[model samples]
Target: MKIYDIPGFPNPLRIRIVLAEKQLASQVEFVKVDLPAAEHKQAAFLKINPTGTVPVLELDDGTRIAECTAITEYLDNLDGDPILTGKTARDKGVIHMMQKRAESELIDPVGIYFHHATAGLGDALREYKHPQWTARAEWGKLQGEKAVAGMRYFDSVLEAQPYVAGDAFSMADITVWAGLLFAHFARIDVPDDCNALRAWKERVDGRASVVNPA
Candidate 1:
């Protein structure tokens, strides 16, 4: 199998952590994608993923998988002993629910704000990521506020549970962790009062996979 992504990027890091958790790092070859250079938007890369995103997974037989959730689902189940996703129906439901929340409420907003409101990735990728919209910066600022609200929402959720989905750590936790990471990069500070979220981040940061991902 081969994974295409830029290292240290938030979305890619999510899959790398999954690979580490599944102990599948050694089984895959990594192909670097030059995100800042707009390599993903080029014709060659678009053939693999029309969405033009990084962290795409290519199976040995030539099947390509895009999106972090899809890649994670494949990797987690490869050994027939899925841990990160979930083992039970209820767990799967909750994990997917929270995972969607993590993406929609937190990470997605931060990304919009980063690319539109700020000079994201410099001039090389600006034209592709940020178009000529008069109100884009204002719209991005609103999304940034939404992301902050998301942090507070997650903080409240964490105050009631050990993990995002429930007792056990799952893909939802990874999504939330990555969302927070992107939030940090976008300069969207978690509210000072979000103690539970901060504590959860500290705990997640100590995990072996997060500490040393693929």
Candidate 2:
């Protein structure tokens, strides 16, 4: 299998962590994509993923998979144990719910704010961002506000449970972790009062996969 991605990027890092967790790093070859150069938006890259995103997985037989969630689901299940996703119906439902929340509430907002409100990835990528929305810095600022609110919400959730979904660490936790990472990059700091979220971050940071991902 081959993974097309830029190393150290938040979305790609999520899958790399999954690979480390599942011990599948050795089984895959990673091809770096120059995100800052807008390589993903080019015609060649678009053929593999019309959405023009990085961290796409290509199976040996030529099947291509896009989106972090979908790639994670495939990698997690490949070993049969499915530790990152979930083994039970209830776990699966909760994990997916929290994963969606992590993206919608946190990561996605940070991305919007980063790309629109700031000079994201420099001039090469500027043309690809929504032309109508590019000048609307105010809207991007609002998204940054939403991301802060998301941090508070996740803090509350963490106060009541060991992980995002529940007791065990799952894909939801990875998404949340990466969301916080993206937030940091976008200069959206977690609130000082969000102790639980801060604590949870420290714990997750110590994990082997997070510290040394694929």
Candidate 3:
């Protein structure tokens, strides 16, 4: 299998963590996609993923899987036991719910703020960007505000529980972690009162699966 992604980017980091957790890092070859050069939008890369997104997984036989969640689902189930995603129907439901919330409320907003509000990857990538950049930039700032609210919400959730989806370290937690990471990249500040979320991040950041990827 081959993984196409831009190193250090949030979405790719999610998959790298999953690969480390699943102990499958050795089984796959990572192919770097140059985002700064706008390689993803080029025809050669678009043929693999029309969406022009990174962290795409190509199976040995040439089947390509895009999107973080879909790729995660495939890798998690490849083993006899699933960890990050959950094993039971209820677990799946809750984890998926929380994961989507993390993306919609936090990660996506941070990404919007970074790309639309700020000069993202410079002029070479402008053609691949959304039209009406000025208006979108104003809108992106609002989304950054929403992401701040999301931080408070997740902080409250962490105050009552150890992890995002209850006691276990799941993909929901990973999404939030990646969101915070994106926040750092985008210059979004975490609420000073959100102590629980800050501490949770410290714990998650220490995991061997995260600290030292296979």
State the lDDT of candidate 3 residue by residue for 13-46, as single tens digits: 9999999989999999999999989999999999
Scored against the true structure, residue 68 in model 1 reaches a CA lDDT of 92
Q: Rank the candidates by lDDT, best first.
A: 2, 1, 3
lDDT of 1 by residue, 1-214 (tens): 9999999999999999999999999999999999999999999999999998888999989999999999999999998999988899988888899999999999889989998898878788887865666588988999999999999999999999999999999998999899999989989999999999999999999999999999
lDDT of candidate 3? Answer: 0.92
Distance (Å) between predicted and true CA of 157, model 3? Answer: 1.0
C-alpha lDDT values of all predictions: 0.93, 0.93, 0.92
Clash number for each model: 0, 0, 0
Give the clashing residue pairs of candidate 3, or none. Answer: none
lDDT of 2 by residue, 1-214 (tens): 9999999889999999999999999999999999999999999999999999888999999999999999999999986899988898998998999999999999889988988898888899988987876456888899999999999999999999999999999988998899999889989899999999999999999999999999
CA RMSD (A), model 1: 0.8
